[model samples]
Target: MDQTQSSSKALTLARHVLRVEADAVAALADRLDGAFDEAVALILARRGRVIVSGIGKSGHIGRKIASTLASTGTPAYFVHPAEAIHGDLGMIQRDDALIALSNSGESAELLTIVPIIKRQGAKLIAMTGNAASSLAREADVHLDAGVTQEACPLNLAPTASTTAALALGDALAVALLDARGFSANDFARSHPGGTLGRRLLTHVRDVMRSGDDVPSVTPEASVAEAILEISRGGIGMTVVVSAERRVVGVFTDGDLRRAFAQDIDLRRARLADVMTPRPRTLAPDRLAVEAVEMMEHFKINQLPVVDDAGTLVGALNMHDLFQAKVI
Candidate 1:
């Protein structure tokens, strides 16, 4: 074939493959019934972890499904069906539930282990394209992941069927997540190294500047002194506090500019005269992401961390959050 003709055919085939896979996933929503619900309930009621088993392409999809379930509050792990036949079958306990994936629903290795799994009292949930296959018939719950055709041009490869199975796995995980009332905080605990974990698990106290690192001046101090404190703190702002270190106001670079524009003498003006009174403050126990939201909403770059009694305990800025990777 000419280069132009070959390129045109390749593009057409790629589009066709994408359409087939998309259609397969879309069809799953319509096919979902009581079986899907039964699968979710079976997994939820199990006292032990979920064991996902498959071979070949389905094995790869099973690994991903297991990981998703594990990270989303479901205790799950993957076990290769081939390995299970040898010795890994011991991992399945009476309280655990097994999700077996096989597009054909006739995988010899899976069928070999089904009788053993049932004998041990563990429930079996089968995901297969063939509803009438032996594996589905033996399963406690059968989820139909069938597709009309493969994304492969030859109509023999597992393409669209595997996509359907993967989508069904995700649907089950999401349903279980909702049924269990799994919150974002619960998800974060399982993914402490991820961005969502950082945003949800980190608090203002973990990132804010405490003790002497916080810049503060008495309300009686001159505006010039507050400016010096701001410069020393390097956070573009300083808190104005009373005798007991309770936050009374805040003086920022913006306030300095206003003072300059109004021709007010910094050396002569008291902090109370030019500072913004009753400025927005955050509790040290608040989530760092909440601080980010508050700053973005108010268009401010700095905030004083206060205790329940309104005492200045710490301070933080946009730079602080960036350094902590909480921004």
Candidate 2:
């Protein structure tokens, strides 16, 4: 065939594959019945983690399903069915739930361990195409992930079937997440290295500049002195405090530029006279993302971090949050 004809044929085949897979997932939505509910209930009632076992392409899907379940408040882990027969079966507890995936419902590796799990009183949830298959008939709950046709031209590869299985697994995880009232904070705890984790888990005190790093001066200090502090601290702002160390006002680089525009004398002017009084501040326990939001809203860069009594304990700027990778 010519190059143009070959490219055209490839694109047509790709589109057809996508349509078949999409249809397979759509069909699963209708096939979801009371068995899905029973499967979810069984997993929820268990006091132990879920054990997922499968072989081949189903095993790859099983690993992803296990990860989604684990990250979404449902405790689960995947174990190879072949390994389950060779001492890995010890990982399954009597009260734990089992989700086994096999398109044919006849994987010898899966069959060899199902009986052992059943004798231990573990709840079994089967994902298979054939309801009459041995694994489906023996399972406590059966989720049908059958596809009418494979995306492959020969109808042999596990394409549409795997897509349906993955979608079904995601549905289960999301449903359980809603049922358990899992919050973003809870999710962050499970993914501490991710951006979501940094945003949700990192707090103001954790990233704020504390101790002498915070630029501060008494309200009686001159604008030149505050200017020196701002320059030395490199946070673009200096906090003016009362005799008791309570934050009273703030002087910033913007203030200096405005002062220079008005021809004000920095050496003689007191910061208390020119500084912004009662500037917005954040509690040290607040989330770093909250600080970012406040800065964005107020069009400011630095935020004074105070304790419960409004005493300046730390200071943070856009740079600090950015450096902490929390911005």
Identify the candidate with maximal lDDT: 1
Candidate 2 worst ten-residue window by lDDT: 264-273
Best by TM-score: 1
lDDT of 1 at 37: 85
lDDT, candidate 2, 96-123, per-residue tens: 9999999999989999999999999998
lDDT, candidate 1, 192-249, per-residue tens: 9998999999999999999999999998998778888999999999999999999999
My TM-score estimates for the predictions, one after another, are: 0.98, 0.97
Instruction: Give every collision pair in model 2.
Output: none
User: After superposition, which runs of candidate 2 have C-alpha atoms over 4 Å from their true positions?
Assistant: none
